[model samples]
Target: MTDSTYQFTRAITRRPAASVVNGLRAEDIGTPDLEQMLKDHAHYVATLKSTGADVIELPPLDGFPDALFVEDTALCLPKGAVLMRPGAPSRMGEVAQMAPTLRSTYSEVREITGPGHIEGGDILVTGREILVGRSARTDAEGVRELTAIVSDWGYRLREVFTPEGVLHFKTDCSLLDGETILSTERLDASGCFEGYRVIHTAPGEEACANTIRFNNLVLMPAGFPKTADILGKAGFEVVEINNGECAKLDGGMSCLSLRF
Candidate 1:
C-alpha cells in the first residue's frame, strides 16, 4: 500500500547527532544551532509523511558527527538497496550501521567493498538509467562496481564529472522527473542531463537545485523563495523546510535520508 508513482514508500532517517558541530564540510561555517535544527527536522519528517511515505527514524549515532546525513551511506534502487563505501573515512562506519535496516526493507542488499568508495550523494537513479558522478567522493572503481551490481537489472550507468566547487554532483543538480532535471546553470552547462528539460534554479539561489521530488510534491529547502517560485511556475507543488543546520554542514534535503 505504500509504493506508488514516487517509487518511494518509505524513508529512512537518523536523528542529528549532538556532535554534528564537529562534522565535516568543505568550508568552516559556524556550528549549527541544535534547537532550531530539531524543529526544522520535525517539519521535514512531517512534510515527508504528508507525501504518504512511512518515515523510519533511526537513533542518533552519537559517535558519528555526520551520521544525520545518512544519504551518503547507501542507495536504494527499485530492485534493491546498495550499501556504500563512503569516500570520507570518518563516514565509512555509517554504511555498516545502515545495512541491517536496509536488509530488512529490501529484497536484495548489495555492497561496494574494498578500495571502492561510493557515496549515495554521488549517485542518481532515474529508474531506467543510473548517473554516477565522477567526483572527489566517487571513483571509477566504485562506479564500475555499482555498474556490475545493477547491470543485470537493465539499468545502464552513465558517468559524469562533478564541477569544481561542488561537493557532489547532486550539490548542483537533481531530477525533477523522468524528463526534467532541476539544476544550476554551471551544472546544466556541463551537459550532464542531456535529453532532459533542465530547469535552472534562480540566480543567487543555486543551492535550491538540490531538491527531493516525492510523488507530485517537491521538497525544497526553505529560504530559496525565488527558486521555489520558479518551481511553482514550472507546475510543481513545492514544500519548503528550513534546513539551516544542514546547510551549515553542506547538507540538503536529499542528504537527510534514503528513500525507497
Candidate 2:
C-alpha cells in the first residue's frame, strides 16, 4: 500500500538548544528566545503524539544551531528515508548526526552524496507525485540526484521553482491533503500547483502557509486567525502553536519534525 500524504505512525523531532539563537536566517528579525522556543517545541511534539503517533524525541545537539529543524535533515517515506545534503555549509554536519537514527529505523537509507545540495524543506511529497523546488539550498543537480534515487522506488519527482526570496519551496505552500494544497497568492500565481485544489492564504497571512497536515490535525502557527479559520471551515481540524520564536529563524510547523 502507498503512504498517505498526511497519515503517519511515527515522527522524529529534536529539542531546541541554546545555540538556536545563532541559527541562520535570511535577515535579522530578532534573536529567538530559547525559553519560549522550548515551550513551543514541546507543544508541537505533544500535538503529534496526541494523534496516536510515536514521537521520537532526540536530545539537543548544542553544536548545531539549526538542529531543531529536524525535517531538513532527511525525508521519511514508507519505503525508507533519504538523507539530504544541505547547501548551507554550516548545516552539513547535521546530516551525519541524523544518519545513525535513520539507519537504525530504516532497512534502506540513501544519501545525496553530491557536489549539489538539497534540503528536506525544498521537497514536498503529495499523494500523486513528489514536488521539489530549486532554491539557494537546493540546486538542479541536487534535484536530479534525488529524482534518480526516488525513481528507483517508483515515485515521480517533479521540478518546480521556489518563489523569489522565499527561504524554501515549502515556505510558501504545504499539502492540506493528497489533492488539496494551501498556498500563498504569490506562490499559487507562479502556477506550480496547477491541477491541484488550491486554497490561498488570507491576504497578509502568507507566513501561515507553511503548515503541516499530520493525521487528523492541521498544525499551523498561531496568530494567523484568518488562515486558521479558513482551514477550519474547509473541514480540517486545526491546531495552532506559537511560532513567534521559530519564525525568527525562518522555521515553522513543518520544520520541526519528520513524519512517516
Candidate 3:
C-alpha cells in the first residue's frame, strides 16, 4: 500500500500539567490554558480530515490517562500495526486499548513484547527502513525483537540513540519522506542512517521534529514559526496547530494520532 492510502486514529485529552512515570517523579511545567488546549486538539483532528486522511477515535482507556493521544506508543503500517511496549510502565495499558482500534481498521495487528520496552514515538518508518531509537525509553532487546518480526515486511531496521535529555527518538528526529528527515541539531549527523537528506532545526525549535506526513502535507505544531518557515522553504504545504498543552505533557503533533 502507498503511504497516502493509510488510516489513522487520534485521541483527544484533557490537559495535564504533569506526567507520572515509574521510577521517575512527575514533572511540573507551565502549561497552556485548558480551553486553548482543547481547541487546539480539535483543530488538529479537523486538519487531519481536511488533508484527506481517514481519522478515527479510540474509546478512552481508564487508568492510562495518557491513552487519549494514541500515537505515543503505537504505529500503524500497511502490513499490520505494531503495539509497542511503552518504556513508561504507567503507559503500558495504552497498547491493549490501541490493539482493538487498529484491528478495526486493518486485518493484522501485532505486539512488541520485551525484556525491552519500545515507544511508538521512538520508531520512524520510511519507505525502505524503520529507524528505532535506543533511548532511556526503548531498549536493545525491543529493537532486536521488533526487527526480527518486521523483517518479513522488507524493512531494514536501523538504530539511533536519543541524546541524554531527549526522551524519545521522534522528539529529536522525524522522517519527512523517504529521503528527507527533520531532526534536531543535537543529533550526531554521523549516526543517522546513510542516504537520508537531513534538515536540521534550531535548538529550541526541536519540537518541529514531531511532524506527520499525509500525502504531500506535513502536520506540525503551530507555535514554532521558524520551523514552519523551514518546512515551507522545502516545498511542503505545512499545516500547523497549537499543541501547547500536549507539548507540556511531552507530546507533539505526531503523538496526537496513529496514522496507518
Question: 205-255 in candidate 2: lDDT tens per residue?
Answer: 999999999999999999999999999999999999999999999998899
TM-score of 2: 0.99
**Per-residue alpha-carbon lDDT of candidate 1 for residues 1-260, written as tens digits (9 for 90 to 100):** 12232456889998887888889989987899888887888888888888788999999998899999999998787777889998999999988889899988988998998587889898876644788898888999998899998886767889899998789888898877776778899988888888778899999999778888887788999999989998999998999999878898999988988988
Better of 1 and 3 by lDDT: 1
Please report the candidate that would top TM-score against the real structure: 2
The better candidate by TM-score, 1 or 3, is 1
The residue pairs found clashing in candidate 3 are 7-260
Model 2 RMSD, rounded to 1 decimal: 0.9
Task: Give per-residue CA lDDT, model 3, range 3-69, as digits (tens).
Answer: 5332334332223222322112235566445567667867877777776656674443446657655
Residue ranges of candidate 1 with Cα displaced over 4 Å: 1-5
Q: For every candidate structure, what is the RMSD over all alpha carbons to the true structure, in angstroms? A: 2.0, 0.9, 3.4
TM-score comparison, 2 vs 3, better candidate:
2
The local distance difference test score of each candidate is: 0.85, 0.93, 0.71
Give every collision pair in model 1.
none
Sort by lDDT, top down from the best: 2, 1, 3
Q: Residue 186 of candidate 1: its Cα lDDT? A: 91
